[model samples]
Target: MPAASALVDLENLRHDVDDALDRHLTRLRDEVAATGPGTTALTDQVSTLLAGGKRLRAAFCYWSFRAHGGASSGAARDAVVRIGAALELFQAAALLHDDVMDASDTRRGRPTAHRVFEARHRERQWSGDADRFGTAAAILLGDLCLVACHREAGAALDALPTDVGRAARDMLDAMTSEVVVGQYLDVLVQAEAWGLDPTADEDRARLVLRAKSARYSVERPLTLGAVLAGASPDRVAAISAAGLPLGEAFQLRDDLLGVFGDPEVTGKPAGDDLREGKRTVLVARTLAAGDDDARLLVTKHLGDARLTDDDVAALRAAITGSGAVAGVEALIDELAAQGLSALATADLDAHGREVLTGLAHAAVDRAA
Candidate 1:
């Protein structure tokens, strides 16, 4: 028997997910190849977007399947991994479009796809304005990603049982639609003319976080995996119970990183979220505290590209002083605790439970 180690065996599972993504991408690229010559940029953008990430959603999907008695033999696990890969592709699509919508220049520590293409166009002295070139390229790239996600998902379920295929399709549909709606809400909130109640603003942000980020990150993937594996509704519910809180904690940590993490580590500039005026739950809560000076500081400094270091320092102090930092930290702890408790009592297999517990710790405890 293999000796037990302190770490979970999720590495092997990660490889499986990677392999599934590779296969699906290969077929997708082939389809793109059949297109006209000038469309090569489209194919390259698709590959670039797929090239990197932590693959958190894929991990969740695989674990959910294993938790629900999914056999690892042959293609059973691979099928679930493929579904997870499709989720990642969907995310890439959302992000590509999101960068364009947000006018973001950077992503994952590099020029966003549109920015890269736009820069290329300028260097080559292309006919159109660089800004328009970037926007057009990003929009097309995002659309291609969306199409690939559906094609990959359909191919994954093509050989599965009818019931399983139906469940997977339903999850894909809901995830796609909800994420788009959440993105719209995020964009509208940035405009800050919604006339929403002050008290409800943070709650609304939380709702968007849950639906847009958290569900796609963990909850929906887990539920979809269990459904595909024919797990009981009760079992599926338990997996969601374990996934949702943990996922939220993950995003809470992300919110903190967006404001404070090192650029070297987070692949984003310091205070990028503030510079973008992202209406994160943390910022919303800080505003809710209604501190007069803090409000003024945020209104003036937040989202300003030309903000000085002193301004960032002041804003950080305001956030910390307003108790929003500590409040969010408390919420992270609570959510992590609740997720672990659910794992302990969940009906999942012992290995699944243990792996998930370790993942929860890593998700919430990491610096980045």
Candidate 2:
């Protein structure tokens, strides 16, 4: 764990990032207000979603910049904060679309955007199908968020040196493209799970984890910060190496939480991933390693949209009894170790090293 001061510093950074996001969104709202009342809901929905998040990406970006000897005051610090805000907006866009794609009902313990819109339609006795209307609205809101993300990043990067700005922009572009492709792969895997090569399930899941979650959530943010700071190539590589494994472990922990964590702690329903039939590494391992009866149990209920509580309980048992839970725990430990080891060799200040180590611990050893 980091010293109290380090933890406080991280918290302060989170507050700064939040303030930046609020200011950016307010400006956006003012600009869009001139268009019409129709867009207000979109901005409101985005604002609501952005209101609550771990802000891990922003923390990683800020600390990475500091680790590479970037200035921590004046315009430099403010520019980094704006870049962090951009990352938050990107995350908002991803979540908005992800909830719709997963047909999820809730997020952060509230009705998902689509579900909220659906209820609004039903209450108003709108003339069309409520579900469709909700989906359309959510999609448009997601698109708007994506545009905002790019715009925010562009503005922040404009304040940097030309080479640094171009590097950050390129990385951001790649990050966005990777996430979209990874998301498509996720949808494809879910659809093809029944016929997917069982031998390749783990590999495929890992690829999706790296692309969809790890890089976007950790590596790219760190790399972007390093780039912005004009870090040496070797130094940038070291940070990325550290971040990638930590990021994967972060997602792996999330996979376990999705099935087994307390809903109150995770801010999501238990077994929601099972309901969505997520072809996660844990699920793939269970399918590959479980006995015949266990396999049958998982196959029968894994993707059932109308899964009852009992069904979820049974599936949970099947997954656990098959030893897949322990397997995933082991993997998380290994990845966390790998990530921490990389950090040991990283050319960073004492504070940077401690904070990154603390973040790795927080990323993996969490209930949510």
Query: Which candidate's TM-score is highest?
Result: 2
- Candidate 2 stretches greater than 4 Å from native: 2-11, 193-196
Output the lDDT of residue 54, model 2. Answer: 76
Question: Using alpha carbons, what is the TM-score of model 1?
Answer: 0.93
* Per-residue accuracy of model 2 over 80-169 as CA lDDT, tens digit each: 888999999999989989999999998988889999899989999989999999999998888888999899888888887888888888
Residue pair clashes in candidate 1: 275-303
Candidate 1 per-residue C-alpha lDDT over 290-333 given as tens digits, one digit per residue, 9 for 90 to 100: 48898778767777877666777788999988888999999999
RMSD of each: 2.8, 1.7
TM-score of each: 0.93, 0.96
TM-score of 2: 0.96
Candidate 2 residue 281 Cα shift, in angstroms, is 0.9
Model 1 misplacement above 4 A = 1-11, 194-197
